[model samples]
Target chain A: MSDILPPGSVIGILGGGQLGRMLSVAAARLGYLTHIYEPAANPPAGHVADRVTTASYEDADSLRAFAASVDVITYEFENVPTAALDLLEAAKPIRPNRRALAVSQDRIAEKDFLTGLGLTCAPYAAVSDMDSLQAAIAQVGTPAILKTTRLGYDGKGQARLRSADDAGAALADMNGAPAVLEGFISFTHEVSVIAARGLDGAVSCYDPGENVHKDGILHTTTLPANLSLAQRTDAVLLAARILNALDYVGVMGVELFVTPKGLIVNEIAPRVHNSGHWTQNGCAVDQFEQHIRAVAGWPLGDGSRHSDVVMENLIGDDILRVPQIATEKHAALHLYGKHEARPGRKMGHVNRVTPK
Target chain B: MSDILPPGSVIGILGGGQLGRMLSVAAARLGYLTHIYEPAANPPAGHVADRVTTASYEDADSLRAFAASVDVITYEFENVPTAALDLLEAAKPIRPNRRALAVSQDRIAEKDFLTGLGLTCAPYAAVSDMDSLQAAIAQVGTPAILKTTRLGYDGKGQARLRSADDAGAALADMNGAPAVLEGFISFTHEVSVIAARGLDGAVSCYDPGENVHKDGILHTTTLPANLSLAQRTDAVLLAARILNALDYVGVMGVELFVTPKGLIVNEIAPRVHNSGHWTQNGCAVDQFEQHIRAVAGWPLGDGSRHSDVVMENLIGDDILRVPQIATEKHAALHLYGKHEARPGRKMGHVNRVTPK
Candidate 1:
């Protein structure tokens, strides 16, 4: 193939979750075949992928063979083991590169990187022990949250400290791992910018989506987020800056806390985010297709929103409401082919679009 | 699974062409796994399907296994062999039913069925020999088309009869098989209704899309087709009538020739039609998904159009223009993972939506 991977080229994806399932479908839309690598048998993406290698990331032989079978590599999750990345990167190009992954993998590193770019985030300090925890509590104040520095998601590995007395209990929740103490910021709502940068360095950002989380999990993401024109511009620009700084090639989700002062950077995900699911119905080109186009060295498609959309995640028992949702007008239901609907597990999502 | 085939249920699809490829993707969106049965190795649908059985329709063991592995059976094409259908129907429920398939498989039968329902169709006569050919020419005048009663698609197995003198040549073109002679209707344009019927006998129809054909292949399908309010209502009602008459349980494409007399039935496809491809961008529930929902015993989704869309097929060498189309705003491309683009082959299509 030339600079652009032609149709029929294999796109290898790591982690065959719902995001990967949608990505594989998007890859197929662009005439590219996707090979999914996941340890779980009958992973959701495996249902749509051209091939699936059911082997752990530590399986070097499988990893090597997987790398040899595709043109480029991309991923659904950011917590891939470093050694697996080292092996895959040696064989094929990996989009959103390792540095992007490293920064997002650790809380302190991510906050430091965002602050280094002059972006505003919550006041935070690293804590490795009780002495450091006491110092962090004093510096960041009593109403703060203690979070593990790495491998944390969906509010897991986190504890709230109502006061200095709760610091001891919150710090104990971290076990022996290092953590970050983040002072609580009074925010009205949360919004995220789903942005992308192509291999050619062209950047594109979708309209910001307002997010609502329940039980520390995303509940719904609505388009036309409640934001002033200036706030919207700021969200897109800051997201673009992060992508440019990392030389990222793929879609990235940058969550922000909209406070009274301005938008505060919450965290960044180096892959397509759940908050961006509304684009599947609101935009001409969805995030999954946009990421595939970027990593495949093709031109980025238009990401302009055409309709107002409310994307509600069908977590666990929310799938039971599908029959009711199916009868509703303008509701597009997308369900992952997971056998069990365990509590807190994402079963599916519905994108409800308003008619023009 | 109750009345509905729950998530992770297998759906077996026969014929692995572009239609099957899209249907497979739609099935995945609804958390249903698809197994493709095709005689050819490396069929397009196989790239995204959960499994593929590369055996001929006549292979009884393969067909048995394919049927045994799925809750329901459906097809992308109408001309599946009789013996294959008999074996498959014995093992699993086939959507649209065998009667719908039988009527659509033969041109004369389709016309007769349409006329039997008090629907208007072009004057037609069946021809099996020279005497019958002459009789058909007398019944259906000059400027007619002689087409094989069975196994005709994409303008294949057809010949144009300009006058009475061309009858012998047109009959010879049938190769001693059965044929139908249709009197030409002077029409302003061709339009189609993509309608669906659920297992519960409920029917839904998308807005009429006007179609333009080139070289006997569908060239483009534009939404909000040129039709009066009354005509649009009539088009949908007639399509629903046909589906109900056949006791159909899936999406059907009804082609109508807009004539001075009224809408004349050009043809009807038992499955998703190329004319309905615009639904992919214009509507919330596309034809593929509607068909999947109907076959899976799920409620049919809303088929309301949300945007104006013009869908153009990328035939053969037209695939080269993808790079250019990829950069266009509001153009949604869907390509079949076919390796080669031979002349007259439909490699993919681009649905261009007008900004809302």
Candidate 2:
């Protein structure tokens, strides 16, 4: 455990996207200032953060300065450059450590780490080249997903194969990048558990939320996910086990596939996740603040939901519905402060409070 | 109603206090940028606002630049200089209007405005000098309060008169400033209705919260106030009437004295009030966000309370308990980011969720 941050301490966030923007807001509420470091100009988080350094990840000098200026450091995205982390970790403490990022950065490593902890993930094999890809496809069987081992998100950098005949096309889609052949897991639905581990190693997880996808992107997360009492206990326990394994301190989103036998791990986000946005309205302490508390060495807040919530992401043209959503009863709207609403860009989200 | 402020438009705020700090956070969530104009250096709102102009209100050049940069203007305090407002109103629209400020600025005007609207307020008489003070006190009777007409806040610039003999001492305490003598009202408890009036004239009011004061300062505000259904309706109706009478387009906190006969108006603040802080934990749309929505010309959101909350102000040494409060379940802490916590200064507040 590191020194507990007082109200005036600064929290440095690496990526200045919507997640960072929200984390900055949460930090400000807790009396901590956030300094944002991003490659892009006018990032959403920069609008709320106390300071911003607009420089590429390759810029070691700027990274050094950003790290020196902050008391504790955390990143919003998984794919942060290793060189930048080396600079940051030298001057400031980075919560969740670099190992979680290393595992989540690659599909093969994430699956290996989860399975190593006695957790069930989709059966997968490493794919190197065309020949190796073909061999891995044979072992993983048909109806598999060929995903780039690194830097892939929101269904990008991947291809789906329905049968053995489609292996060649899927292999070509990898573009010579290290890939993983994962056998598809037939499941009833997708649910996520947003779990937080404090500096003291105590863990707390919100109730799992069922998720729906549209065009391979998260569309909505409905709270009070359909789960038997046994499954709910299993979900929370596995999430805690993973955090303890990593010696992690921060909120991590664990996506799971509910199956007849048990729940299978999909992936984990090292920071606050989109699915957990419902906590902003449904719970006393939300995921953003939960992450801040964990990293700041403060005790984790109660991660209990008081009301049922349905959180819908506003992507691209979805922003046009702001006026209408403004009039909706019990609707809490949060925008990312992005100037241009590009297609597939997460503009904001609306959380609707439903009857418990 | 003026043209609606689009998501990216800038909202100018006059006073950069804690109220402005919360308002800036709410505006950012709604995708609007805020530019804070405050006389103080390094204000709490400036930490979150997109831009901050630190100059005295008398600085015409700075005020001009601030007005030019924002699309519309609003203020967090009622004591804004009339000359500064004259310059600002010429360039941009000020929601809640100058009339609201004028009415709330002077004790005599505030009382007269309420009485003219058929809203029952304690009887008050204007007093300019010693003769006028003696005459007004004779008419309003003993056990009255003598208050300065303007520039008074937080129980400052006022004296209580309990008897005819106490009139001379109370008048002397006024220091020859224009004053008003208000007759005392016997009430069981103090309750305030945090209400919002949108540009479309539609009004919404949150459930009244009972307030407790210590040393002439607000201590805590508990929701689900002890009031009958009829009293609750009357409170909301009277708040709406006051907003309509002022032609207001923003949030207003109306303090009421619940007496045997009816509710008597104590005062009204034409901005987010400290007593309404519980809404941050109890409602999806809080007073700060409600004021932002009303001033931005957006439709009003539901002001219904979801959880019963007790809001406690952390004044001065009260902030030392933050460490313990952080560990408490269902506690939402909002700090003003004041570097120094002097006695009587509000350092932060804690909103605790309690069973209804």
Candidate 3:
């Protein structure tokens, strides 16, 4: 790729979800143009982007056209098909690389990559067949999870293996697709470190945020996540180490479990994550903007927080309460332009800032 | 008019300037779509809006189509042609109403309306001919200004009369258009109150900002304008009174001259003003979002300030210094995506915030 793309260069976004919407806003704020390529008609990101191309991701013709129009391509979700990535890579530079995407696309590869970096992870083994499932269960013991290694988000594509007997049916239900069996850890809390790595190899991480999930979806995130200064420093260093090892050139979110021993790696998302939304109201620059800067080859902003912040997601019909939230003196409300209030769908988020 | 327009409802914007661009961002934040209609092909607001229609205000067919595509219409600049407004008003609601626009579109009418409400203004008289100009000059005396009554802004279409003998040439230069001759007020400082009036009759104002102008364009605005407690209260009260009188349903900027006697009304913009740019970083709800809320029939946001702020305009080549300005811990940089940085053009703004 060229040394650095200018500010006016167009950045192509793959998925038109809320993350894409915010990324477009951030990109525009930095004097960069965004062109959204999403298969779905009327994707939310199209509202603020410079242009929108509505076509199926697997349509090679459309993908090529979209790729030709942009200087670099990035995606909001990790589940993009490898074939789609191949087509885009042939046309323009793709950041975070296809290798990072492949490593993060499945649970097994992700865990192995982290473990290879001398990072702690929950004990896990891959299961390809029923016999292998039983062997994996024997190795990791019962009371583990059997999760499909691909196309899973929130709580989908996973089942709990209460006992060894349930492993056979779980594997059968998987239909012989690759899966991972992992032992559950008793984590005190869940936290995530959102960090960005520039093309020039500079990395910076925001303060870790303690996250709470309801039904496998993030409910809220509170910053200064009650960690010791040592723990916080360790979490940031771990995230930076992962970004460097991967040669990542954009924002990466690393989810960690605070166990009795220390922080254990849970998963890594190669895009802006929901846990860092508080930065929109509390910090000088937000995660989305930081990601744009990193991808656009600009200098990273000081990701320092001006205040303590709490971000609460407005899921489904929870958006109707925005009026009450808007009345707060320190609250900043952001609502996505989703027409349907479908259950479990993220509708918006609100950030409340308190002076440090 | 409907109490609430749905998410996909198109909002027609009258003038495609920087205020319109910021308003489009705010509208997109609320999930309402924006359609920009401007005579200029490459309007600033068009860069980010969903659609752009380039046609003259006199083109009824284009105006009809633009009005028909959107549920409601609003303006960025106050000097919208009355005929175009009539066409738009025939189709949908024109917010802040044409009456406020009419009052503000003319300098003499604005002063008369404010003074009719028992408010103080510099002495002024209408001049339609050379005789009237001489008589008005005799009354207001020298060192006053002779300004065309219509379609004037940012120190344009106005000439300073240094002596009584220059009144005839000034009036002749007006080219038979209606004009206003106003007595000059020696002021210690110039300040403005950015206030919003909700559809439900709620009025809220940010703290008045002391302004400094250079070369007929605003250079900087500093909040907490060295005003005493009584003066601040009076400024807020004046803004509220103007909103109530106009029955305004959006953000209106009231500029005042801080004279020896008291605060005198200078002019009013029936739309968001440049003076409120500080709110984008200093207040909980910025003027753009406040204007959006007022027009959408939503409850007004808390306009409380979190910090003392100074906002500097980045005109023309000043935008090239964004990188240097971005390094400041307290400065938030905002750039308008205008493709060309012409001389004296408002390219962007930066706000420096400090704790009150």
RMSD of each: 1.1, 1.4, 2.0
The residue-by-residue lDDT of candidate 2 on A141-238, one tens digit each, is 87999999999999999899999788888988988899999999899999999999999999999999999999889999998999999999999999
User: Which stretch of 10 consecutive residues in model 2 chain A shows the poorest summed lDDT?
Assistant: A1-10
Candidate 3 lDDT for residue A102? 91
- Model 1 per-residue lDDT tens digits across residues B57-170: 889999999999998999999989999999999999998799999999989989999999999999999989989888898898988999999999899999999988987888
Q: Rate the local accuracy (lDDT) of all candidates.
A: 0.94, 0.91, 0.87
Clashes of each: 0, 0, 0
Each candidate's DockQ score against the native complex?
0.75, 0.64, 0.48
* lDDT of candidate model 3 versus the reference: 0.87
Cand. 1: chain B TM-score: 0.99
Predicted candidate 3 versus true structure: per-residue lDDT over A221-254, tens digit per residue:
9987978888899899999989999999899989
lDDT of 3 by residue, B133-228 (tens): 888988998899999999977788788899987877788778889999999988898999999998889899998999999888999999879788
Identify the runs in model 2 with alpha carbons over 4 angstroms from their true place. Answer: none
What would the per-residue lDDT of candidate 1 be over residues A63-147, giving only the tens digit for each residue?
Answer: 9999999999999999999999999999999997999999999999999999999999999999999999999988999799999
**Tens digit of per-residue lDDT, candidate 2, span B267-318:** 9999989999999989889998999999999988877898899999999998
TM-score for all predictions? 0.99, 0.98, 0.96
Better of 2 and 3 by lDDT: 2
Q: After superposition, how far is residue B151 of candidate 2 from its true place, in Å?
A: 1.1
